[model samples]
Target: MEILLNLKNRICSLGIPLHAAFEDIGTDKTVELWSEIFLNCGQIMKEQRLDAGSAWKKVISENRGLLPLEQADWDSINDFGELLGKSDRLNQESVLDMARESIALLEKKAEEAMKTKGKLYRNLGALCGAAVVIVLI
Candidate 1:
């Protein structure tokens, strides 16, 4: 149970946009998928006798080629390493809080990106309108 919680916390802290994607898809579907993955992972850990650290290490080693988490997310990967180093000292609430903060930061970044894109579109439209007026003159 500790290993499973650790694994879940680590993954959540990565802030992979899964939760945001889940929100877009609908809460029920999100809950269902979460439950499925949780159960599957729990079973794997039990059957394989894989501790959380070993399981995560195996996943990175085996699926580095296929995992976005393994590539280009160095900061998060580093953060995970730090978390692992201190895992023995941290309480569950602290882990959850870290995950929540990561998710919030990602969501804020996504929103800001969307706002920037919207502003760019508006600027482009204004530029096009100016070009049309200049052509008419």
Candidate 2:
């Protein structure tokens, strides 16, 4: 549950850099902007002791139920990363759309998580704890 909430928070915060990077692309070479985005993101991930690509893979892989806030959301993020990680030429405008789409997705998921998911997790956790106590007794 904590991990889920943290993931949601992390995703939401990640959007700030993405948005800024998208805007930066308008004034700079698309390729250079993308390199900066990946570098900045990679550095941030490093601070958390996570590799650029492995962070997403590790978090999603390690806890399935914990962060299944939305499979589509995860897929979109993964796709975005893959797109950026590639050598293919990506249009600045199209990249902006992708970043915007991802931002919106994260925001929606964050709102939904706060509204209900957190409570559900708390309740379920409590139930599990009670079950463990009862079993011991």
Candidate 3:
């Protein structure tokens, strides 16, 4: 989410290309995969003379098994690629903003689910430990 936000801001304010924006955002150390994805997409777009959308698709396809995203996140990412570099600057920014929003919502949902499931697992572990203690006694 931070990367997406930073990319959008950079593209909108600095008018940087998608690949450049991604490269800048990829410098962050929070997630290694994001850096790899950004660098790979940049290389694909530059070397192959492909558009941002096509380059993004290629990168995603190659890294599909390694990505830890949910279905909604994947959909948002693919959708963002479809609009990227296919329209005017304003439209590109709008697409980025929309993708950021979609990812933000997905993050919220994931956080909520984590909280709920974390409690459940903690309780389950406690119960199992109690059962084991009783059996030993």
Candidate 4:
């Protein structure tokens, strides 16, 4: 149970966005795969007297930055893929590789966002400074 709980926590922390992304895909096989993984993890957690759902909530709260699509959410998908590849229940290298690729794409997006934010801040500061100088003059 401890093992399953740990596994689930690790997976969630790594930010696979499993629930939503899996739902979006909407394939039986994908759902089955996720269900099996979650079930096995839950069974392990149950043995240890730990509630898997609660554990999931706690993990999310603690590691919110690791979530995908967030400003600080970087490399989470890759990390999740690596975790899945390492897990005994579902060790698929190809899946891990795909996830790594997804992470790279996400990282690129993050970089672009940062650049845009920097430019906007700089422009705002310049405009504010110019307005202040004109008022002082």
Top candidate when judged by TM-score against the true structure: 3
**Total backbone clashes of candidate 2, pairs 3 or more residues apart or in separate chains:** 0
Q: In model 1, which runs have C-alpha deviations exceeding 4 angstroms? A: 1-28, 31-40, 53-90
**What clash count does candidate 4 reach?**
2
lDDT of 1 by residue, 1-137 (tens): 23334444444454323223222223333355344433443344456765434443444454345433423343443343233333433453466467556656765766887799999999999999999999999
Error of 1 at 14 (Å): 24
Instruction: Give the poorly placed runs of model 3, Cα more than 4 Å off.
Output: 27-31
Clashes of each: 0, 0, 0, 2
Clashing pairs in 4: 1-44, 1-45
lDDT tens string, model 4, 1-137? 23224334444454444343222332324444444444444443445544434433443444555344563453342244223423442443344445556657776887998899999999999999999999999
lDDT of 3 by residue, 1-137 (tens): 77776777777777888777666666666778878888888777778888888888888878878977777678767756777767777887788788888878888988998999999999999999999999999
User: Which tens-of-lDDT digit does each residue in 55-118 have in candidate 2?
Assistant: 4454445444544456766666554443332222234335545666666778887898787988
Span of ten consecutive residues with least summed lDDT in model 4: 20-29
Looking at candidate 3, the ten consecutive residues that score lowest on lDDT are 20-29
Q: What's model 2's overall lDDT? A: 0.49
Q: Which candidate order results from sorting by TM-score in descending order?
A: 3, 1, 4, 2
Which residue pairs does candidate 3 place in steric collision? none
**C-alpha RMSD in Å of predicted model 2 compared with the true structure:** 12.0
> In model 4, which runs have C-alpha deviations exceeding 4 angstroms?
1-58, 65-91
Model 4: what TM-score?
A: 0.45
Candidate with more favorable, higher TM-score: 2 or 3: 3
